[model samples]
Target: MTTTSVRARFLGDGRIDFERATLGPVANGQVRVRVDVCALCGSDKRLLRSGSPVVPGHEIAGTVVDVGADVTVPVGTRGIVYIPVFCGTCRRCAAGRTNQCLHLRELIGWQRDGGFAEHVDVPARCLLPVPDDVPLDTAVLGLDTVGTAAHALRLWQRTQPDGVDRALVIGAGPLGLGVVAVAGAFGVGEVDAFDPHEGRLATAVDLGARAAGDLAAENQYDLVVEVSGAAAARETAQRVVAPGGAVIALGESDEPYTMPATPRWRRTDCYTVRSFYFPTSEVEANWDLLRDHGAALRDRLTVPVTLAELPDAFARFVAGDYFKPCIVSEDAP
Candidate 1:
């Protein structure tokens, strides 16, 4: 039998065009997913607009269309693809830390094709079951944004046992919105979010946060988080960390940007920069956490779009539209 699949490809310099591709027989520990709904992360926006031959979507949810010989996923199983692929024999993989494996750069969109397509081929270990109650959009995001936030939250809580007395999130991107929503769900006190964009600042307030102009001015908070590390945000966070407080750095970019460090106060704890990756043994940890807050996150993920609308959606991505725009297929649930 022969099969054809449709997917999107970026032809370097900011052009994303529709294309057709084929899938050969599935390999060991691999499965094919028919994408239902995929959320475009900030990185996808950057990469797509950078003009590269890359598949754009990383946060993807779909049904299992086929399974490789050694794969256990049954056809029709609904799930999201965990994009961090690793070679099992490597030292990092052997220790069950696939995300940090040296070969991670070679997997998913970079070396192998990714989920901007109708069908995605992934390792069985990378497919996570989508909860029946959670919608496809939420499922995809749970795998990344929410997962990272929960991981950071756990570490943040460990640093200050009294529970969140005050919190600061610095960014207006989707991840920042997600951090705001999670902070509310987890009962953070004095939720102060800083973003220059009036629209996103208002959205933060709507999501149960108190919008503020400068985090450093509101520096009384015990916990500070850097989500995007913009020049302004970095400058603000240096002043925002409370004396002896813990700061979680969650942003993705590391340009040659020099950040202004705020004068240190003696009663202070230096910031902690966390760039977390997926944990393997904690199998489906993200799904479990999402189960706890899926409904509300589903509400946060209410921004909707269509497959044919991808070009427009991506254009808006360049223009910064919506708090978090989610691309959906006709039958997405």
Candidate 2:
């Protein structure tokens, strides 16, 4: 059965165009999702400027409306789209590290058509079931915001098995605020956050982070999470982390990640841990985190908009007027 879907196309240089397209008879191994909500992310800003060949919204929460051959997911099942199109048979996937799948190539919103539309066709395996208690807007955060942040912290725990005494988050954007919200749950003590935007920093404080007073003070924090891909923020993370501490880098930037060859940089001994999106293995645990903190985070970070208002939402998002703008469908339950 074909469905007519309204989707957004990102034309280069901050332009958005909509198209009404004929969607499928459901491709094999894929299921069609009627997008309930799709949250805008900071990474989308780069795509906004440069343009994307595919639909660009990855933080998706929706209902499975149709299924392909061999699929057993019932229609009307609620889920958040998992971006990574992993080869489930790969060695990494077998080990539950699906994010690092050996044959991974496409991410739903990056290489494939995604949920900036009335409906999106995604690999059946990419549909992560959302709990009945969680709203679609909040469930969307379980993808990028909470998922990435939790993965970064879990990786840090591998190096610092004793748990963090004090942690610092650089950049209080959605993901940074996410790190703040879950840090205490991960056994981190005294979470502090630094961001140039007063409003965002205040939101971070409301999420349980103390305002970081000095970004220049060296050797203070046990763990420093760099969620803003700004070069200066990267530098600050390295400077402030105590020796033997870990710096979890979750930020994405077009600019090359570099380390300046200064004396302090040369001498400081610390772990620079970089993590990708969360593995499917962690989804259950993440649900628990979301149940505890998701609604509050969503209330502070999201401004709801209709799909047609996506262009304006992006403008406000770029202007720092919206922390996380979500395109909510009128039919959304």
Candidate 3:
């Protein structure tokens, strides 16, 4: 049977155009998802600006429309596709960390065409079952963002220094807010989040953090969580981190940021840990961290938009104003 699919394709040199394509039946080892909702991640816009011609959206959640022979998934079953594909025989996959595998591009939305399309194919091993009640739009958070946050939290707990009661999260974007919420859930006595944008600061507070005054210089906390991708925020994190404290730099800013010249503060007696790929990778690690906080947070943080509004929302994101804008599939499965 033949079917039509809609897609938001990046045609290179900072261009994203929606187009129609035809899809054929899945073959052995492949599963097809009737796309539901997709999220515009920070990485997508960054790549566009950097001149990479690639499918943009990575956070994807949807329903299974077709399963190749020998595949275990049932038709019409909703799920989130784990983006990291692996050849189990590889040393990295053999170690059970698929994301680190060398042959990991077969997954949707990264090496191949991603979820921006109405239908996406994936190797069977990368599929993960989404909870029946979880909204497709929100379920994508589990596939990556939440899982990444959870991973960062676990890493921090393992590397934390003594006498750290507070955590300073330096970015107020969705991932920054995610770090804040997870930090709070991790039992940190206080969580102070920072963002230059007032609108995102409000969103951060809603996600369970006390908003810091927009990157203004302050010497305030013991633990610094830098999820802000700003180049300047790195200095802010280094300045605010207390003596013998830990600075967890989780932000993904494009610009190069230098630590404050003061080696006494940034290096001496302090721990600097670069954290990434949290709750987004290890389910067992992220599940317990977010068992109580799921799609509810996404609902509070996301602004639902249809495909038609994508450019406008992306424009807002470019101007540093969007807060987890998720696309609603016109014909969501």
Candidate 4:
């Protein structure tokens, strides 16, 4: 087939440009999806700030419209596309850790074209089928937001076999929100969410977690998930985790985190801290979670807006006007 021309949006330097671009033909073992919905992530904000030329979306859910040779799923299958483009022969891919694949050629939103367009072409291996009952936006959230949280939770589980007593999530953003929601859904003993925004805390509370600015009890929480990359938040997470408790840091920050000098509070031997990133299997499980709690998750999503409104909407989103905003295709359900 000839090169496909599509209208797509490029975001960089806090600005968005929409124009007609010619997309290359789908390669072998690739598929083209008609994007139904794509959501903004914290990483998107960072990339926008950098003014780098990227398609700028990793959380994508859409319907397959075309496929290259040897594709498994037929055209018209609806699903969420995995972000990492990895070499299947790599050891990491063999172990189901595609995110860590040494031969990663591209990350859908970061290094390659993503879903902020009429159509996105991706490897057929990247497709994870979403049940028809699940909403497209919810499916997208399952891949990035909930999946990241799930990965962290799995790390915590590996550390503390008994499970969390009291859990603290430090951040009120989309990832923080996902942590709180998943904790609630999984029936954690007590989940407390901390954030600067009252609105976000309110939403956290609505999702079955107690909202607070900080943990009152020192070294009380068995699990502390640091979703906010702020140095202060990272320090707080370490301080509040009980001895031998698990601290999963999912946030990314450019600055280095320094340990306190004090002996009492600076006990490095007291806890376990692990960094996490999303894995493919976790995202598949997240889809199941989304299926069960789709309505609740849907409630947290900002009202969908058309692609034309994304620039202003993105500006507003950065200003804290929206928590998680979805870009809706005109034909999206």
lDDT of 1 by residue, 1-333 (tens): 234778887776667788787768878778888878777777776667575555767778898878888776788889877777767678888887766776766656656777777778888878878767776777776766677677677667676766776788888566777778677445577778888777777777877788765443635667778888666666567677776677777777656445454345443555565757465654466666667666666675457787667777778876867555666777654
In model 2, the runs with Cα more than 4 Å from the true position are none
Error of 1 at 182 (Å): 1.9
Provide the TM-score for each candidate, comma-separated.
Answer: 0.88, 0.98, 0.87, 0.92
lDDT of 4 by residue, 81-101 (tens): 888887887888889887788
Model 1 whole-model lDDT (C-alpha atoms): 0.71
Better of 2 and 4 by lDDT: 2
Superior candidate under TM-score, 1 versus 2: 2
The global Cα lDDT (0 to 1) of model 4 is 0.77
Once superposed on the true structure, which residue ranges of model 4 sit more than 4 Å away at CA?
2-11, 184-187, 213-217, 270-276
Compared with the true structure, all predictions reach lDDT values of: 0.71, 0.92, 0.71, 0.77
lDDT ranking, best first: 2, 4, 1, 3
- 159: Cα error in model 3, Å: 1.0
Error of 2 at 127 (Å): 0.2
> Higher-lDDT candidate among 1 and 4?
4
Candidate 2: tens digits of C-alpha lDDT, residues 1-333: 999999999998999999999986999989999999999988888889999999989999999999999999999999999999999998899999999999999999889988889999999999999888888889999988999999988988898888877899999999999999999878798898899999999999988889988676789888999999999999888889898998898888989989879899889888999999999999999999999999999999999999999999999999999999998999998
What's the TM for model 3?
A: 0.87
Candidate with the larger TM-score of 3 and 4: 4
Report the lDDT of model 3 for residue 17. 77
lDDT digits (tens) for residues 1-333 of candidate 3 = 556887776655566678788888787887888767888788787666653344557777778888888898888877777766677677767776666676755545666777777788777776777765556666677755677776667667776623346788887777777776666666577788777688878877877788675555455677888876677778788777777677887777657756666645535467777753522247655545445666656776777788767777788767776677777787785
Q: Quick one: best TM-score, which candidate?
A: 2
